[model samples]
Target: MLIRLIYASRAKSLGPMDVKDILESSRRNNTAAGVTGALCLSNGVFLQCLEGDRVVVNALYHRILLDPRHDNPAILDFEEIIHRQFGAWSMGLVSTVADNQALFLKYSTGAQFDPYQMRPQALRAFFTELMGNTRWLA
Candidate 1:
């Protein structure tokens, strides 16, 4: 069955090139694993949505828990979906750059993007809107 998992985590230490390295590795690894998703990094928090097979995604999430770079990982949403929202890309990076500030604030509860404070439905809505409007990093 196809499943989508949304999770939030704080970054242990975000280096200047860390996000770049993450995108590269995620694109490469997720492509081979048949996973598609978008990763958003803002305000020292990582909000990511991963979609794929149930067992594969579950295993992937568990592996993420072991990664030292991420801290306090929390699953925000998980459900079976009829189709993938990010089918075109293996892994997409969403940035909180200047142009995307307003977009991010729309769903944010305060001045910063805090997915942990967002409800599951709000998180789902955020991603649904994000897929079409946000400027993605390469």
Candidate 2:
């Protein structure tokens, strides 16, 4: 069955190169694994949505828990889905650039983007709106 998993985690001292390496590896690895998703990084937090087969996505989430770069990982949403929302991307990166500030704030609870504080429906809406915006990194 198709499933979507949304999770948030605090970053543990990441540099530009580290983020680049993550995107590169995610694109390569996720494509091979038939997983697709979008990653949002803002305010030292990582909010990611992974969509694919149930078992594959679950295994991927477990692997994420083992990564040293992430701290305080929390799964915000998980459900069986009829279709993939991010079918075109193996792994898309959504950066908190200037142009996208308002978009991020719209769904955010406070001045910063914190998916952990957002309800599941709000997170889903945020991603849906994000997909329509052209400002994301990829």
Kindly list the per-residue Cα lDDT of model 2 for residues 1-138, writing each as its tens digit: 999999999999787688899999999999999999999988899999999999999999998898888899999999999999999999999987888888888998898877899999999999999899847685
Model 1 ranges with Cα > 4 A deviation: none
For model 2, the run of ten residues with the poorest summed lDDT: 129-138
Task: Write the residue-wise lDDT of candidate 1 on 27-71 in tens digits.
Answer: 889999999999998888999999999999999999878878889
Off-target runs (Cα >4 Å) in candidate 2 are none
How does candidate 1 score on lDDT?
0.91
Provide TM-scores for the models: 0.96, 0.97
lDDT of 2 at 127: 91
Cα deviation at 63, candidate 2, in Å, is: 0.7
Candidate 2 local lDDT, residue 17: 88
